[model samples]
Target chain A: MSGFEAATAVKRIGDGRYEADLDGDFGFAEALNGGYLMAVLDRAAVDASPHEHPISTAATFLRPAKPGRAELVVDTRKAGRTAATSLVGLVQDGRPVVEALITTGTLGAAAEPVFAGPAPAVPVPPLEECTSMLPDEGAEGFAGQVDMRFDRSTMGWLDGTPSGRPEIRAWFRLRDGYGPDAVSLALTVDALPPVALNLGSKGWAPTVELTWHMRAVPAPGWLAVHGTGRLLSDGWFDEEVEVWDSTGRLVAQSRQIARVGIGVRK
Target chain B: MSGFEAATAVKRIGDGRYEADLDGDFGFAEALNGGYLMAVLDRAAVDASPHEHPISTAATFLRPAKPGRAELVVDTRKAGRTAATSLVGLVQDGRPVVEALITTGTLGAAAEPVFAGPAPAVPVPPLEECTSMLPDEGAEGFAGQVDMRFDRSTMGWLDGTPSGRPEIRAWFRLRDGYGPDAVSLALTVDALPPVALNLGSKGWAPTVELTWHMRAVPAPGWLAVHGTGRLLSDGWFDEEVEVWDSTGRLVAQSRQIARVGIGVRK
Candidate 1:
């Protein structure tokens, strides 16, 4: 299995129950990324459902998840011919860490959009023209597991000259060669750093709640991730991200409301 | 109590449990609105929590909820000094109809935005120049309970012109004089007609999943609602709505994915 596949792999223990290991590679320092945790929970939902794709997911981050053994409890809410809905809970040490309501359905590989609105205005330069987010010293944990090339314009925060705008655009792909699919799309939608970073904020912005939808089957190659925030007020911010496949088709979309973290000048 | 307050009122039965009457006035024809259902659920979350406002909510509609007596089960997932999260379920006939993850907190009445993006470009004409959605025969059910004045440009769908766009902008408020607040903001964010209407679809478009966030305390009066869709493909469509208070401040935001109703031309 690829690194991502093995990292997110789950073993079925019984009906609607599975055991998984919280891979540290998907974490930042100590806590797991909200998107990475969502991908793991989504794997359980798809395995327990009759459908093949996780069409929509609403995830609430109750607490930060640490690296260790975790259990997933899937409570089937409704199973329908078109789609199935389930409440998948990620529990660690007998306490719920994250809970998600996932709706699964089958997506045709060749299905085309009946109608698509204007794409996001996040144009990226060539891969060579972009700067790698990998640290010069060495890549570890999340940075080592995913390859991200960021658009230079949005990376001013790295140099301490933070752009007042809250937006980030980048090209994302798994370092382990896992191709783009429904499960991978889950991770890709949240691959970019929090949009709050560009708003002159420092420290980690924890996602309070996030909802993402799989719009279509993505094509292979690196995915374009464009994230933007609408408002930042009262120690909270809301971000909307659009993931486009290499073929220029919007594959997945996500919106999350998160804490502003410490050191937010604006 | 006002109509909205009386209709969404819940009687505490026991610890983390409440009973409510699913008012038919919030329904369209036979089924209830997803936002209205969310308001009722939020009421339960707030009642069970030590917080003052429902800050975030992620709702999954398993089945259509009808008007009648329903039981709400609020399971406290996490409670902290700053915020609290609970899993609130609405059960009818012993079956789960809607499940929502609600996070509650207190919002300052005089809080100001640290940073806000440009408002949505859904301009509306003067109230008198706009057309009311109420039928000429007489307003009833949802239309009678809520007053909506639509922008003429987006109302082409009513006359079969079918704007060929996926968007709806309107002015919304309760006819019974219910002032704007966190709970009412829940309904106001989803009060606009489905954006898919302009795409030439007919019949009831049912919401599968919706997540909304309360950004600030709204000033009492009419709210400007702007809704738009990014994609409608493979029997599903995504809608995003922004609700601005009468003071021209963004108060609430919501995004939902629903099954495209039958009769879509393109």
Candidate 2:
């Protein structure tokens, strides 16, 4: 009954429409691993909306599915009290592929903090001594889905060099027994922008493309994330991450655009 | 002599590194929008080397411009061969506030194609031209930077409400802009999200954010962009567009994300 609950399955197809099937091993080798299809469409948009509130999702990836069954259909365009919006689609045999949008609500007083700045002391290190750098080895199949560590002040993973400071900070979670939900905390806050563009580049970086912006949604515990990156000489790279949760709050904010390339000179 | 006069100007050191005085108006709104502060530091990358090679330029904000001045400096960033890459940032007292970074070279070998899917189907129009569509109240303070198009197929302008999938479509641009360099190509090839949340959603969709992999820069052609959206239950909603060119060659490609408020509701 495990193995991502027997290779993912979810039907119901009507009342609120539901359909999802994945059969492939969850350690992802493809067959829909964009953060496990964005945590199965963020748990089918929280089962079509149960609401505790706090949402913000964004997805796009037109094609890339090939394991077996991958269908999802959720609906409900708008609900409002404060806000609510949904849309999910990721069909496989019939076409579609991937498309998402979720935007729950309940936290907008706009108190006026205006971005205080701080949050960057950097230093976590401890996931069994932390190591995994990953600039690509197929992103090491996401090294068993998070728990990553890293911290020497910064720039350690990927060993690339440049730690100048467009930023980089880590410490994520998940891995123990899973179950934090919210689509596994948005798949561990979408793996910190390819580890902050391969440690804020001095050389060698890869991501091709990635984007996340979840404003709020964290409660379960122990998360950190951070990242920053912004290289642009044409090799193109952009990262701006944020996720807090050990009580620091924030929760989520991501933006990644990569196409780096340059690490195979041995 | 175009290539934008080889660009040169940007220096505003009060000591923030590219400083230009502060408090708000951030560096005099980037020295009066000197082409949106040369497209935000023209791909930055400071001390690691690489500079020059951006192909386009345009900016216009006027007024503000006051920062520090020491004749100012401009040195964007660059690195190319077959992957092409560039960057240009500026600031000068008398006149000059440019930002550039136009790269072109990646997508190597594998060719053989001629436009297969999106582009050339135009016709849109319905959703009541987008529920009331407002903005031009005489362009007050510039109305959220201008993004109100309904979509009668590609060129509508801005308003709202439409849902997804019509071969993909939607619009919205200008988180900030002023015009010139074709208005930074209206925020570089606007309209995205697997074609704007699949234009209303029903089938076929994938693009968890892939602005053709961003990194190109240069602008001004106009501004005012578009993208209306919808794609329920499956999750998706996107907005962040701006791309103008008239005689620039790189036509259009905005941005969007949608999957509004999932199930339940009533």
In order, the first chain's TM-score in every candidate is 0.97, 0.32
Candidate 2 global lDDT? 0.43
Among all candidates shown, the one with the greatest TM-score: 1
Best by DockQ: 1
* Best candidate according to lDDT: 1
TM-score per model (chain B)? 0.97, 0.38
lDDT of 1 by residue, B1-266 (tens): 86999988999999999999998989887889889999999999999999989999999999889999999999999998878999999999999999999999988889888889998765767778888866573777888788999998998888889798887888999988997888888888778878898998897788999999999999988888988999988999999999988888899999999998778876
lDDT tens digits by residue: candidate 1, A155-175: 999888878899888889998
Worst 10 residues of 2 chain B by lDDT: B108-117
> How many backbone clashes does every candidate have?
0, 110
TM-scores of the candidates in the order shown: 0.98, 0.33
